[model samples]
Target: MTSTLVVIGHGMVGHRLADRLRELDTAHRWRVCVLGEEPEPAYDRVRLSAYLRNRSRAALSLVRPDFLADPRITVRSASPAVSVDRRARTVHTAGGEPITYDALVLATGSRPFVPPVPGRHLGNCFVQRTVEDIDALSAAARPGRPAVVIGGGLLGLEAAQGLQLLGMRPHLVESAPHLMPAQLDGEAARVLQDGAARLGLHLHCGTTVVSVDGGAGGLVRSVTLGDGSVVEADLVVFAAGIRPRDDLPVTPALPLAERGGYLTDAFCRTADDRIWAVGECAAVLGRCHGLVAPGYRMADSVACGLTGHHADPLDEMDDSTELKLLGVHVATFGSTSGDAGTAVEVTFQEGASRYAKVFLHRASGALLGGILAGETGSRADLAPWVGRRPTADLESVLFPAPPFRPLSP
Candidate 1:
């Protein structure tokens, strides 16, 4: 009476689905099979930079030792699914093994987007994605040397920070006018830029890398900027963005979203009901959410659908994010952009290190979205009031009074 569920790509979100399924399937109604392309089991990629500090792989592992020991759950590491036979409901692996499944899920996740610039394929160029990538970067890092980090977003800043931790001077380059343009407003970005400068990070904003020049042995030497300037570099790390890995080979090609990723319904189901997708691989309603929270929600939805429970639609997936880069706290929730000019804005600032801005509905006082930079102590408290009006006064909500402290004797 039991059915088989095969999941491809044993990343964080993929493993969550298997774990959730086992938790809900108390009757042992389903057996799970996880296919991972990496030789090691799932690890915390979000904390990948931590590996640079401790040099411990086990510390980043997301899987518990005993979790995979269950007889109902089978894990095959270093086994990448090469193709899927939709008609036969079979997944073929690179090792020439075929897995049959009653229900199949794609959690292939995403790949780091590398921009096409000359010498990008040089030996010193790397992408910040996996532990192995970090290891490679650590091996190549030399103290006091200059390193160029492409992109100035969350991941790029993290990579730059990691390199700085490794004793390299990091020069961050971004095509955008300011850092973290996607997550921060202009004022917030300015605050972050000042903070970054204080941390000894050289930033190149509003410019693109025209080309990367390499020295002997095909190793990167320097990068040419669009403004006819060049920055010397011993290494370059790309953290521009990500694209979903939805191009997996299938007998009949699966439809893809316009922005890339397997097209899926709100329930994370593909055109074929038996096949589903979760995580970055699933493009629900023609949009792909790059954050892990939304991907976890998608995984839960698919698990519920497979278990005969009412699956929640992807409409409620929260894309809010909180981050700390080089000792600076930044948080963004809901719609931070008021470009359409339909919302009323509230702003507050204190010195060079603190800034907060919230957008409200023009007619209703309901929260539209907001950005917090420098001080994010209220992030957890403010997140829940994202779409709804706050019970407390707007001033108190935006700037909660500091916790009382006893005076020194």
Candidate 2:
């Protein structure tokens, strides 16, 4: 009998996994179905902000134009998986179609996590996750319109900048005392805030949005703060955070973490050996990595394992990350949380334009984890070295000064 594989969610990792499976097994003996809830094919959700700021639709496409034409694959758009009956090996769709499968892959991914604040459901408020989200916000954003982004993290900053691109004045409202609180320290966050301001984005740290005022036709007009001050806003984009989408109504208890992610082993397999979960939905090592790289790696590992390849389990310590955000070069790897060590921590800063930090284990000279900002040259050179070498070599490499450059082009 031909094996059937059903992949839920047509996001980045899901679509890539489907493509990889078809490439590895070209015999067309096995049937594959990719179900997507969205109306269009898989697109790059990572760059959705760019779409809001006038980027062409072609730039956001993740799959090739001819992807749907593949014979071995069935692309089902506007179809959402409503339930998964693991016992029957069938998944029920929103349209009441029960698709039976030998193997099931849940790549449900995640959705924007909006807090339970008052007036959150008001019009003129958006979450920048989908192409439709960008289209709606772009149409509403006009020149001199006051825009506010709640949550001063990566997406929040990007949304603020995107609004600025549309000639709207953007203000960043963060509840934390510092910006990028998850990745940067107080001093480092200050540098990021300075850089943001240079781009005409206002930073409002340590402020909470108590409620959104939508007196004008249920469309957001302004945000009321905890301090009882009202900041006028024509539109608001909530990039506060995201939660994994795992709403399958199954009777048998599926292992799930406290954070609502599927508890999976290193190979992205669930407690049930035949079933697997990958991407943002899987919580490996008791943590859910929201980044795309880890999700891609998980997808590859599972695909390799299914095809009889010598696939290894995921490493518990995946401390390697490097990327540039909005022209700011930032990289962080290993252990930002200080460990019990005998070693040294060094930091170098060049005003608000450049910063570099390193943490080392004192006794063994192991490179724990570090952060780099503003120095594109150093990040490009050091990120790989940090991943490959132990602490001793990192110590011998000697520290270098950070390169200073203005945030603006």
Candidate 3:
């Protein structure tokens, strides 16, 4: 009997998993069914903001237009998995088709988080997650419409930049005290905020939206803050955050975290062994990794385990991360803890656009985490050492002079 593998989200992680499975067991006659809720093949969601700004749809295509030529993989666009009958080992689609599978993977990724505020239902309120959303927002937007993006994280900042390109004066509202609170420290957040302001983004920190008044004709007229202050705007985009969509297939009894995510063991398997979840939906151990790299690692581990190989469940995704955000280079990693007194940090600032910070555990001298701003060259090469949990030469590895210059140079 041929084995059937049904992958629910046809996104980047899903596509990669399907391709990897075919590579591992080609002779076994495995049938791969990829279902995407979107009406198109998987596209690079990471570049959605760039698509909005550059007005280029071709840049985000993950699979070729004629990807269906692959004999082993069959795709269903605009179809979603409605429910899964664990006992029958079959999935029911929204269109009332039953897909029986020996193995089921829920790559049903996360969705853009929109907060509950008055007038949020207004017509001009938008989000930039899918191509359709970008098209709608692009059609409704004009230069100098006074747009406000709620959230100061990576996505929010990126959307703000896109709004500026559309000729709108954008302001960012962050509930946290600093920007990119999950990725950057207070000092680094300040640097990022400065960079954003230079790109014509206004910042409103430590503020929450109380209500949005669409008193104007079907458009967001102004947003009232918790402090009774209001800012007038013609449009509002909620880039607040992402939430995993687990409300499908009749809401399984799978354990969910307090912060809203499906709980899974180290191997990315839920309580039901036949159904394995990956990507943004599964919370490995006790934490849900929001980034793509850790998600991909989880996909690989599950894939390997099913093929009867020894692959450890994902653990400790090297707290360090470095990236170029809207032209400004930023990095952070490890335990950047100072109040616990378990780590020591040192910062070096040469001039206006150069800064580096290194954090090390006090007793073990192990590099916990660090950051490089304004310079991000060769930062990825250090990821392996950080992922392996070895005691690094903090001073030498981060601040190598001349011939052994560190990544930031």
Worst 10 residues of 1 by lDDT: 400-409
Best candidate, TM-score-wise?
1
Per-residue error (Å), model 2, residue 181: 0.9
Segments in model 2 whose C-alpha atoms lie over 4 Å from true places: 26-29, 317-321, 340-343, 376-378, 387-409
lDDT of 1 by residue, 6-107 (tens): 999999999989888887887899999999999998888999888899989899888886778888899999999999999998999999989999999999
Q: How do all models score by TM-score?
A: 0.96, 0.91, 0.90
Clashes of 3: 4
TM-score of 2: 0.91
- By the lDDT metric, which is better: model 1 or model 2? 1
**RMSD after CA superposition, every candidate:** 4.0, 3.8, 3.6
Give per-residue lDDT, candidate 1, residue 160: 93
Q: Which ten residues in a row have the lowest lDDT in candidate 2?
A: 400-409
Residue 220 lDDT in model 2?
90
lDDT score for residue 350 of model 1: 68
